[model samples]
Target: MFEQLGLIGCGLMGGSFALALKRAGLVKRVVGYSKSPSTTERARQMGVIDVEAPSALLAVSGADIVLLAVPVAATEATLKAIRHLVSKDMLIMDVGSTKRDVIDAGRRVLRDHVGSFVPCHPIAGKEVSGVENADVDLYVGKQVIVTPIDRTQPEQLQRAVDVWQKLQCNVVQMAPEAHDAAFAAVSHLPHLIAFALVNGIASQTRAEDFLTLAGPGFRDFTRIAASEPKMWRDILLANRQELLEQSQVFQRTLKAMEAMIEAGNADALEGFITQASQLRANWRMGPKKG
Candidate 1:
């Protein structure tokens, strides 16, 4: 879709995008920058990007499209660091999980140039990270959420959609608030529960023995607990209010289940299990990629 593309991060998601674009011949050249010099060198060695730039601004300079693939906390600072160097003709977009903060940050720095900026979130990732873990088809047929405010231009929105579509993503639109609320329920809450469960188990007696005897169900349920702690911490803090509400709802349900077990209410527990099983089954059967 563009002659030259700029990526500001070379981690899993960023590297994956670079690989996908190259495989699809969507861009003639891909330039990248990362805070860690070693990561930039590694990304180049992995052939994820055609070249590595010395600085974020230099990397994005003269590029037709610039993608901010850094963490949510770094979005505003990255935008400001490259504000003076970014051209008005360049289309800027961020793959941040939360949208409102990023959209507001763009408004502050982009101003009239905001027309070229789009807020987006790709709902695809792996527990592993870095260039080595990046896959060229990571986003193929995966749902990508594009959250645009009233100030977003139609052309810019379409450009963002086209880029993602070229990567073989299934595009979906949502308001920033709604996106945060929904993800809080599905994504954030599950991570929190997984973290809590693992920690809770570890704090008890015979923890090592318990883990040694754990089966596939336990391993699968707690796999997300292995994710980077810092990233999940930032995500939780960014979506605190929504996450808190979801936590309360989850706690109530857990309490109800506990009460049923305590009273030996077999029918009530059976009903709860049936309802939850059906919901999970529906999710598993739902249309989704990989």
Candidate 2:
């Protein structure tokens, strides 16, 4: 059990972490801070946090475990604010979708104290965001990737894994680079495609008319298009290189299928479709090393 959990951000991810920790009886107190005062106040009013900290530094004043649930872009500033109090004894983690940029920020801001910071990406969340939508079960049974850098303290890393495991999360650990590359292929690129797909259709003159006829397949495929714009924008930019590489691979495959269609080669097109269908049908979700 932790004496205090200093939660920064106080949005859906942060608030949900606090609620989950409280419900699991792992944290005795939660001190939360957000860039928006109203958000911090709302989190406190909703019982997501025991105290509303006025600043990021104050949030970690006496916290043994700290969670930075802010956007990837704000990581450096957040770490700079709280670096004065960061110590090897504290187990600090972030829930950013991208890891390399966050690790770099921790290294730069925390310096020698970087060992206390463990980069984490929880494969969980809803399309909608904010403190109001925070749910206690957000992390339950979710695959949380803990990406620890070379400078990370072993004891603190173990503590992070333990905390997530206690919260009923299937925790997996990987190096920061590997984590970024793998997620770029599986998560980031998919969101990018969904966003582009929606925008491409909406750009047409019959955008509204086309949407009116969209069925479950279109809705399901473009579900991630409704994700928080700012958050996804930061994620895509942060992991742009790897995401671009994945995009190129996807384009190549798409072009191959398009070529078959253009040539009117039914046999080749059918074979290609059958192969893709079989591959997707045989795919099983689970944690595997990068």
Candidate 3:
């Protein structure tokens, strides 16, 4: 636990951490700084942050812990702004959806302090966003991946894990590259598919009619499509390389399914559908690759 937590970006992800720390009695004070003044003020009014600093440097002035929860594209700039204030002994972590790019950003901006920056991605969020929507328990029972590089300090890595564990998260360790590849499949690909599916439907002449007749399946599949657009945009582009690979993999499967359907090969089509059904039905919720 730290005496003060310096939070950069007082949005849903960042505000939720401040709320979680306060709820768990972990940190004594949380000083937040967001690029938007109104956002910082909103976080203060929502009781998510104890203090709102005018600048990122002032936010971490004397803090022992710092967390960056900004957009993935903004990681380097945020780190650069506070690099001078980051101390060697301080514990630093990020709640990015992508790890490799974030690690690269740390390398670019943090330089000497890079070892203290333990790159992490908390696999939890809501379709809605903003500091007002931050939930103290958003991270509870959710997966938090810590991807440490060769340059990462052992002590800093352990401390980062401890912090997530304190918040009731299922902490898992993975290599940064593996983390990017896995999430590109499970997380990023799905979001891209959702956005595509929703937009595709809307492009048709009977778009409104199609949507009106849509039911639970459509709703369930496109639930994430309702999420913050800018956030997903950043995520999709940040992990573009891995996502492109995943897309190619998915394309192969889609073509195979289409081939079976077009050829009226009912048995093969059923077998294909059943294979996916069996996998999903048998898969149990447990700590994955921790």
Enumerate clash totals for all models, in the order shown: 0, 0, 0
Cα lDDT of model 1 by residue, 1-290, tens digit: 68887899999989998899888888888899999989999999989988899999988877888889898878889999888877667888888777877887888987878878889999888999888898998988788999988878888889889989898888889899999999899889999999999999899998999999999999898889999777788788888889999999999999999999999999999999999998888775214656
Cα miss at 150, model 2 (Å)?
1.5
Candidate 3 wrong stretches, greater than 4 Å: 288-290
lDDT of each: 0.87, 0.93, 0.92
Residue 69 in candidate 1, Cα distance off native in Å: 0.9
Q: Candidate 3 residues 64-93, lDDT tens each?
A: 999999999899989989989888899999
- Give the CA lDDT, 0 to 100, for residue 129 in model 3: 86
> Model 2 segments beyond 4 Å from truth?
288-290
RMSD of each: 2.0, 1.6, 1.3
Ranking by TM-score: 3, 2, 1
Off by over 4 Å in 1: 285-290
Compared with the true structure, the alpha-carbon lDDT of candidate 2 equals 0.93
